[model samples]
Target: MTRLRLAGLLLTAAPLALALPAAGQAQPAPNRTLRVAPHADLRTLDPVFGSIVITRMHGLMIYETLFAWDSKLQPHPQMVESVSTSEDGLAWRFRLRDGLRFHDGQTVTTRDVIASLKRWMARDTVGLKLAEYTAGLEAEDERSFTLKLRKPTGMVPFALGSAVGQIPVIMRESDAATDPMKPVTETIGSGPFRFNRAEWRSGARVVYDRNADYVPRAEPADGLAGGRVVKLDRVEWTIMPDPATAAAALQTGEIDIWEQPGQDLIPVLSRSRDVRVERYSSLPNQGMLRPNHLYPPFNDPRARLALAYATDQADFLAAGFGDEQWWKRCGSYFVCGSPNGTEAGAAPYAKPDLETARRLLAESGYKGEKLVLNSSYDIAPIGRMAEVAAESLKKIGMNVEVQFADWGTVTTRQQNRNPVDQGGWNLFVTTASGATMQSPITNIGTNMACERAWAGWPCDAEAERLRNAVVEAVDEPARKAATEALHRRLAEVQPYRVLGQYDQPYARRVNISGVLEAPVMVFWNIEKK
Candidate 1:
């Protein structure tokens, strides 16, 4: 079993509740709310429109998926009651569980599921691959649907249940019918929580109320699967950009949970008796440096290789996370310690080589052009990693400029495809959960689909072919072989630089319990005492 480590020293501390009610306002009962300090501000609510993790968390809170993954990485039915495949394995049928109702008092039907899957497939990597093999998808009845594929593959259920980048969340047919590239105005779903749109304050707070009409699974909660029993009447997300203030809030009982606390503050938080720092997921998060492939310097593979040769994973990891126990050097494109974490082709660039970097830079014909490195100061780790990258690139004789902004602004600016002088970026630093980087099919960083690729716009025919082989392999051994080949290809192409892997522990009050172990932050199955 995956263990949840509780780190804190026992000490006498005064018991305190949340903020008192305003003048003339009635005070609510104790322990009826779960207050959280999220890692980033909630800017977008449409999960299918982008790969933002915060939006994915918001979607999970209000929307339900047809299937879900357990801690063991096994796919199981969530909203689905039963699923069966044909003898040839080309056709699959699914039936929704009874009593599933949307927050707007509408019954969940096959039309909603089909529309949601169609929109999700238009953006998610796994969904796109599934669409390639899909021959037909249609509703059989109000509560059932059938999907026919051109070839027999096991990706149907896995794709539907995957909780990776841009999760496949089921929404109302009316909302799902919106353009996949655009955001939906309405926030309606059949999940455990109903989004409080009227109470949403963009940069300050987001609110959700328990769904009284919703019915959960009978089984106990495990990872993202099983029953999602909500014990609290309300889940309030308070956005605190500063790490110090967030830690202070967690320690004083102003907030019940702190989704992410910096490593530098973990020690102080651990010393407090009221707060417990726990590792929620066994898989560590993987940090990456993504370069724009459409502009100069990085447009050439040699230049990308030069940057890779100059990078030191240890330096990047140490700067972002102070303690060595929280981080490790990783070279694999896929996350280290995962099922496909093989360092097959990373032998040459295992250590930093300034000579190789300089030589490669010269060969690529870089002319000291200004390279903008977009970074977010609000997220301390990302800002630190960008600083290290800027220094490393300078060592390779490249003109580097570090642009600092809040995380929301950074995320928005990186989407611009203009040149550096026109607000475009040459590189940026970010991290993905280990579960998202466990496979070539799921890892958005390794996607080489040219114009259709993730923000980086990496394009390589050989890399794409290798990834497809891994996805379409007949057996586990074949898939492993294909993945190693893809890894070797990625080393040559240098699509992105893998800084390292590290664990981001969660800090919550002692009164909070039943936190399910998962790669992502989940509200379900958690209760306040």
Candidate 2:
């Protein structure tokens, strides 16, 4: 698993002078404003339309969920005041928390909540499944709503409060009414912070101002739940693609926090007494290689299988993370170290077999068609994974063409469903939070609902049936059995290949406090002292 040259492949530090601010640019206020170097720039503002983590983070900044997960991953009411379930668990009633208002001063209503859920259902994997069981979702009054289910299930609150994938955020009815497939340009929400759209610069910076009218919950802050007290007046995200430049900024106190510093740059940051590196969540980040199932080569199961045989999890983990202490070669479709993380069907492709890969490629009837591999050079780990995958694919006698771009551009281009000649993509490498992959229901990669599936769009009826089994199981033992069956189905279907798992540690200044531990990054509780 260890590569001799892996350490050298990691990012090397650049001179601290490279991170100096432009002349005449205003400096960030000492304790009032907190400037952060985000891993990627803000491109997609519509949370429902984009499945990227950055978009989810943006959504959390200005939008609130009905329920949210605490640090322990337990569902707790956030925007909802209370929920009551029927004896059969088929019917549920929800009451909205008082004083909830959009940024425009409009009161939050059942109309908005229902519309937002409908929009979210059209996109989110869990929401899609929830819609299947929903008999009716109607408003009882302005602040209350009722959800009648066709069958009994206990996944309602968990699905609504999901912290990973595309979150079910409450938006204005007008914004939620916009087609789920299209982007909602307006950023109006009733969360703790308001997006400063006028101050946003695409590739450079983004700003958010504390929502003065926001009423924090009476409870103490915990993960994405409880009170979201805004201690700082403003939060600014400074896009720094280069790890070296970000490290320099953190060391010089130019940036209050660096969301994800490259593994190689950790030493550079550790040397600075002012900067502290820490893991935000206990769950590891799992890497994945998603193939366009609609396309020719990948559309064939054998071709996809060829990818599985050729993929070396060790190569990916070593290349992307460099440090063996930080990453592991995980074969689980569900994240390794998680409850349902079993390697049931992973035995066949546990190790790379170039001979088997070539055989599978031949059986798939693939000629010499070029496979477009979309990759991002802006993010270190993703870029390394792409490089390793391209090399592995070429070894299997596949025509692999790597298309390099910034993370934001790669994310946008991946949405294209056209042929490669018409700007479509064949494959792309990305990572999901381990928290999202802990179960069959939460993991978006396991979705095989054809058109409704995530970007890759891999459809398998058996996989869908198996996932439903896991969702419908009555107890832990039954659920585990169903999950293992689903995991086996996923391995055979090869919807998305799990490369490996690694911890992504965040670095911040010592003065920063109150950073909550959650699956994804949120800006509400942190304060710069």
Best TM-score among the predictions, by candidate number:
2
For every model in order, what is the number of clashing pairs?
A: 0, 0
Given candidate 2, what's the lDDT at residue 516? Answer: 93
The true-versus-predicted C-alpha distance at residue 524 of model 1, in Å, is 1.2
Error in Å for residue 406 of model 1: 1.5
Candidate 1 local lDDT, 197-303, one digit each (tens):
89999889999998877777776678888777777888999999899999999989999999989889999999999999998888888999999999878889999
Note the residue pairs that clash in candidate 1: none
Error of 2 at 79 (Å): 0.5
Give the Å error, residue 368, model 1: 1.1
Model 2 clash number: 0
Residue-level lDDT for 164 in candidate 2? 81
Off by over 4 Å in 2: 1-31
**Candidate 2 per-residue C-alpha lDDT over 419-506 given as tens digits, one digit per residue, 9 for 90 to 100:** 9999999999999998888778878888999999888898899999998887777766777898898888888879988898999999
Give the Å error, residue 146, model 1.
Answer: 1.2
Off by over 4 Å in 1: 1-31
Candidate 1 backbone overlaps, count: 0
